[model samples]
Target: MPSSISVGREARKANRRLSPRAMFLREFFRRPVMVGSIIPSSNRTIRRVLDRVDWGNVRMFVEYGPGVGTFCQAVLDRLGPDGQYVAIDTNPDFVAYLRDTVRDPRFSVVQGSAEDVESIVADHGHESADYVLSGLPFSTLPPGVGDRIVAATRRVLRQDGAFLVYQFNPNVRNFLTPHFDHIDYEIEWWNVPPAQIWWAWKD
Candidate 1:
């Protein structure tokens, strides 16, 4: 049997794993626009988003602004081996961290803008996505950027696909309503700051 000293060393190694919340704070301080939230999303918020996914038929899923991958892991946990999960983030640090940490064959981490969803999906050899989850701070984005992202999301999603977005405020509804045919909204107050989830889809 291993000695107590060796067991203690193994325990310490496990505890050294990087905290996504700490990473979020560090990145937010460096680039508030890119990082968005001061802290990583809570499990409540993540569950709310994941619950909206139609896991049975969802072959391709895209995540916008997946900072430190709070939702990424949840999605991967439920995504099948044949399913494809692509995460796009403009922050290089978050991208690198995700690439190094998330080890799933169905996962791809791209360092790019959410506005490029169409081309990014094409580059990955996927025609369109079944679901697109956005963790971006649309309300805080510059004029027209949020609109462009919403438009791009609409363009890249399949006819039956869904666009799921969680925002600190309801301001993004204006941008989403014009692009999607139907919209459903729900509020989850268990998060660090209460969040509103919007599920939009075309007829």
Candidate 2:
């Protein structure tokens, strides 16, 4: 997703594809509960997440379920000098691999559930994040788990913070509706099976 790292339109477009060395599907198995993708079947949405965010105004950011760190690179590129990236995923294999794949000193990868972000960050000495982006598949979560994660996110996101979530299903609106001050969608016409982007900002 780091478009600048690989110049040229063709290369940039190609860069959007999953990394050849990436263990995307295998990593998904590490935490079936959080992986939105059925693996190879839904990998395209991961690339879409990288292509849709505002590069500026992003300092300290957190990413949930950053499988293969596709969006992680884009976020780090846009981050300010003191900017830091904290990525949390339920997949331990992914957390390990993603950590090793990134070369930035400012990036931190955590192998844990998204529901524990606040505690995880506290351990790392970060109070709350400027932006929190999530790729967790919320539509099918067990009843209270979805709400619990949202509440945890709200606690870790500053008042001016922005949180972005990408889902293949529109039902996500229900989980976010009562909690967020704003919820909007960005549609991707060509993504495999097509998809919707959900943007949530705190009041």
Candidate 3:
């Protein structure tokens, strides 16, 4: 049986009929740098990024800037029974919305910067993440923030874990190059504005 809190949340969600795209646009206008895009990531982009993951071995999957959870359900669908998905974002509205909407035992959303990913993962009872995905606009992040997030992500991932990233700006790869020995990437032209996708392995 569902708890009263969850039941209440569901009722509120039903009453709040705003679509995800509408909510995304509202947030983007408020914080374009943080939200990254006016619309949710294209389906082609999601598939291109997620399909690279070895879902069978993923125990903990961490995502940065999940903006309205465009990748949440897709990750959940492929996640193993015991796998956990932790999404970190600085946007309170997106965090609250995801908490209310994404009802799954394996899903957890945190309202915090990705720079604290190591401690965040620890607090959630995980030693290391098998994968960390980010769609953050590193090129526009406040000076030093992007570096901190990349360094922290490297430390939190297991040896063989991978960091998957998709961004409008390909310069984000420069952030990953120093930390990972091997990175494979390409452009997904099917997206509205097209997106640069990357899979950087910790090796």
Candidate 4:
């Protein structure tokens, strides 16, 4: 029988071999409502999301529904050595793939729901996050689930921190308005189905 160490190594290798698009497709097919999109986010959408962040002041960041980590690499690249990143995804496959692919000490991958952002962020030894990014499909989620996630996001972010969300529809803006002091919206048509980006901040 293979040793546990050998089994673990094989799992990691398998995860590494899975492409983001393939993983997205598999997960989407398995759970359309949970996976949200049929394909991984495009480079254009990733840029629009990351570009809105004030990287200079960001030290701790959290990502809700990281999926296959399309934005993970870019965020890691832009982070300083001391910067910390944590990603939460309810999909077990995505969580496993992220753990194997994003090999960075500063990164933490959690297999949990986005509504638990506060406790999850605390598990990583953070009191509050500088930025919280989400690729979650708010329009597809149940009203209660979406509200809880949005409320948790506001509670866990520092006063000066920002929340960046990208969705296929503009409905997310309505959900964010009550929690944030200010909100800004932009559209990226270069993406597959196009995307709407929202940058929200509190005083």
lDDT of 1 by residue, 1-203 (tens): 99988976564344336687777788899988766778877898889877967898888999999888889878988988789999999876777778778888999999989999999999988899999999888878889999999999998999878899988878888999889879989999998788888999866
Every model's TM-score = 0.89, 0.78, 0.92, 0.92
Q: By lDDT, rank the candidates, best first.
A: 3, 4, 1, 2
State which candidate, 2 or 4, has the greater lDDT: 4
Error of 1 at 177 (Å): 1.1
After superposition, the stretches of candidate 2 with alpha carbons farther than 4 Å from their true spots are 1-22, 28-33, 39-56
Ranked by TM-score, the better of candidates 1 and 3 is 3
**Candidate 2 local lDDT, 1-203, one digit each (tens):** 65744455444344345472347755556556667665432445645655545556555688887777767656776677777888887765566566556889889988878889899878777788777887778876778888888889888888867678877788888888878978777877666556788778886
Model 1 vs. true fold: TM: 0.89
Per-model CA lDDT versus the true structure: 0.86, 0.72, 0.89, 0.87
Residues forming the 10-long window of minimal summed lDDT in candidate 3: 9-18
- Whose TM-score is higher: candidate 1's or candidate 4's? 4
Q: Give the per-residue Cα lDDT of candidate 1 at 164.
A: 92
After superposing candidate 3, which stretches have Cα over 4 Å from the reference? 1-15
**What local lDDT score does residue 116 receive in model 2, on the 0 to 100 scale?**
92
Q: In candidate 1, where is summed lDDT lowest over 10 consecutive residues?
A: 9-18
**Where does candidate 4 stray beyond 4 Å?**
1-13
